[model samples]
Target: MQQDERQRKMKIMEVRMREIELSLSNVKLLLREKVAQLKEQLHKNGKADVLIGNLYDENDVLLEVLEKTKQRHIILEKKNFLLEEKISSLNKIMCDLTPPPSLPYHY
Candidate 1:
């Protein structure tokens, strides 16, 4: 009876060891899959970051151009105002120099 019991316990231990080995192999396979997914995600994120950086640079350049255009517009507006004033003054002088039409006398 003692020998039979020892033999049964040894058989159970061997089965358990096989099960543990299978579980370890499954875990290793899962870890390898997860590592591959993470690497792919990292590569995609790097490309997105570079594109965003380029857009930011372009936006900065556009802003600078807009500012310069706004300044030039302001300068032109000021010059136009001065020209209008001069034209108005010249018109007044021309009106003063012209003689008024005489009215017809009623009998």
Candidate 2:
């Protein structure tokens, strides 16, 4: 009877050990899946970071171009003003140099 009891206990212990091993395997699988998901998220975030950096660089370049264009516009305006002044002075000189018409001589 004691031998039978011992055998039964051994069988029960074996069954329990198998259940524990299955539980551990399931936990390991879940951990692996979670790690994969985290890695995917990290990769996507890295791409976004690079894209954001590129956009910032583009914005800085555009700002520099705009500043240069504004400077050129200002210089052109000053040149136009000087040219207009010169033209006005030339017109006055030309008017002063012209002679008036004279009356016809009497017989």
Leading candidate by TM-score = 1
Candidate 1, which segments miss by more than 4 Å at Cα? 104-107
Clashes of each: 0, 0
* Model 2 spans > 4 angstroms off: 1-34, 100-107
- Tens-digit per-residue lDDT, 20-99, candidate 2: 99999999999999999999999999999999999999999999999999999999999999999999999899888877
Q: Residue 47 of model 2: what lDDT?
A: 99
TM-score attained by model 1 = 0.81
